[model samples]
Target: MNRRKQKKLTNRLVWAAAVGDTCTVRTVLRTGVDPELPEADGTTALYAASVHGAASTVRALLRAGALPNTESRGITDGTPLCGAAAWGHVATVRELLTHGADPNLREDGGAGSTPLFWARNGASGPHPETEAALVAAGATD
Candidate 1:
């Protein structure tokens, strides 16, 4: 895999995950692209999938060895769990937690908010289900 080819595959994987294209994600994974590969600004495929609430894509990435706690920088600044929680995506949050996302992990790009903080103050409104899931996963304020 040359650097250019690897970058192209990684871009495809990231775009596929962002759009919830689970099939594409799996196909790219099979091609041996690193599941943890980040985009130019440091957004991993798992983080992109999680932010979109793409649970199926999230699962595919996780199964392909994406780290659930990996953080995104620049535009989408946070861990995958933080991104999911901030968007009030309970299923995504659960998927991340189940795959070893540290519920207590903080987003360095913000005020270092945890997943719990995002769930409570989420722009989508306070998501009780998301909050509950985070709490169950041992997330603290």
Candidate 2:
């Protein structure tokens, strides 16, 4: 695919993930879109799905080969695990961890925040299950 087509398809995939549309995500991935394609501002489908608490979408994307630790560069730039945990999505966090997501990765924007930091301090309030999942994964190290 040409760069333009690739970018467009990536955008579609990201949007689909953000909206928790599993069918669209699967369709987009079927077209050969790179699961980790970051939008111009750096948002990725996996990050979008995670932040939206779209567990099934996250699972589909991960099974489609999305990197669990992939981070974006744009306004929403963040790791999938961080996004999931920050939003109090225990299932999503657990799924990412099951896929080997590194919970200790600092926010790519250079902040000291890890998934645990976000889980413990999300604006949505603390999510004990998310935080516990991170600890169980050795994130405190």
Candidate 3:
């Protein structure tokens, strides 16, 4: 694929992931675009999908080999697991954990918040379900 076409598909993949548009996401993936492709600031499709609680999109990206634990910057800043936990997306958290997200991985920037920490101290409020999912996945402190 040409650089121009590849860039367009990558943008589409990121947008689709962010909006939970699993159908579009799958189509982009089929075009041989690496699901791990990051946007200008380093947000991968999986990170975008996870931050938006797009569990189905997350699954599609992961199935295409998106790394569950990659640290990202840009619209959001952290691992996909941290993004999901911080938002209290229980199903998204579970999907990431099931796909090998390290429950203990810490955010690179910020105060090194782990998924459990984010779940317990989310700005939206404490997320017991999210916390529970992290704990069940072996998260600590």
Instruction: Indicate which candidate wins on TM-score.
Output: 1
Query: Can you tell me which runs of candidate 2 are displaced by over 4 Å?
Result: 109-111
lDDT of 2 by residue, 1-141 (tens): 999999999989989999999999999999998998887778999999999999999999999999998787769867888888888999999999999898798887557589999999985999998898899889884
Give me the displacement of residue 23 in model 1, in angstroms: 0.3
Please give, for residues 62-131, the per-residue lDDT of candidate 1 as tens digits.
Answer: 9889988778887777889988988898999998888899999888954599899989998687889999
Model 2 global lDDT (CA atoms, 0 to 1): 0.89
Residue pairs clashing in model 3 are none
Worst 10 residues of 3 by lDDT: 105-114
Q: What is the C-alpha lDDT of each candidate?
A: 0.89, 0.89, 0.89
Error of 3 at 107 (Å): 1.1
* Residue 53 C-alpha lDDT in model 1: 98
lDDT of 3 by residue, 18-90 (tens): 9999999999899999887787768888999998999999998899999998888775679999998888999
Q: Clashes per prediction? A: 0, 3, 0
